[model samples]
Target: MSFTDSTEAPIYAGLVEEQGDVPAEVRRVAEEVLREADRAIDFGTVGAASAR
Candidate 1:
């Protein structure tokens, strides 16, 4: 999934920047995690109903 707004990139970038110099692989994984979190938040914010 992708971000719906441009504002998210900078916030995510700031999160990455705060980590200092992390290993390339670790950084990649962290970014993937952040993206997933952003997707989940967006889905929740838009009020998508859930069966559970």
Candidate 2:
């Protein structure tokens, strides 16, 4: 599920339309989410390598 597909996307879109940008906290949280996703992928790769 993506942010756009999520129920929150509509609310976020409305805020962007009205405010001209996402809130700073929202942007920061998004960055953190992406970083955590990256780390999860990296960890999976490392685990696979170790298993092999």
Candidate 3:
């Protein structure tokens, strides 16, 4: 998903490289954040992203 967002590539890459091995709970929230990012960006919504 983020592979298409060049603007987010660096950050995504760093996240993968750094916290890719996080615990299950942390990974779950991270997944939620990524999904939310996609939801916000895909919809071009403003407030939704920060609502988390």
Clashes of each: 0, 0, 0
Can you give the lDDT of residue 7 in candidate 1? 70
Specify the poorest-scoring 10-residue window by lDDT in model 2.
Answer: 1-10
TM-scores across all candidates? 0.37, 0.37, 0.37
Question: Model 1: per-residue lDDT, tens digit, 1-52?
Answer: 3232337676655655676435666879999999999977776645655643
Where model 1 places Cα greater than 4 Å from the true spot, the runs are 1-22, 43-52
Q: Which stretches of candidate 3 lie over 4 Å from their true place?
A: 1-22, 43-52
Q: Which candidate number has the best lDDT?
A: 2
Q: Distance (Å) between predicted and true CA of 37, model 3?
A: 0.4
Judged by whole-model lDDT over C-alpha atoms, candidate 3 comes out at 0.69
**With candidate 2 superimposed using the best TM-score fit, by how many Å does residue 38's alpha carbon deviate from the native?**
0.3
lDDT of 1 at 14: 62
After TM-score superposition, what is the CA distance of residue 43 in candidate 2 from its true location, in Å?
A: 11
Across residues 1-52, which tens digit of lDDT does each residue of candidate 3 receive?
A: 6542546687766665667635556979999999998977766555787787
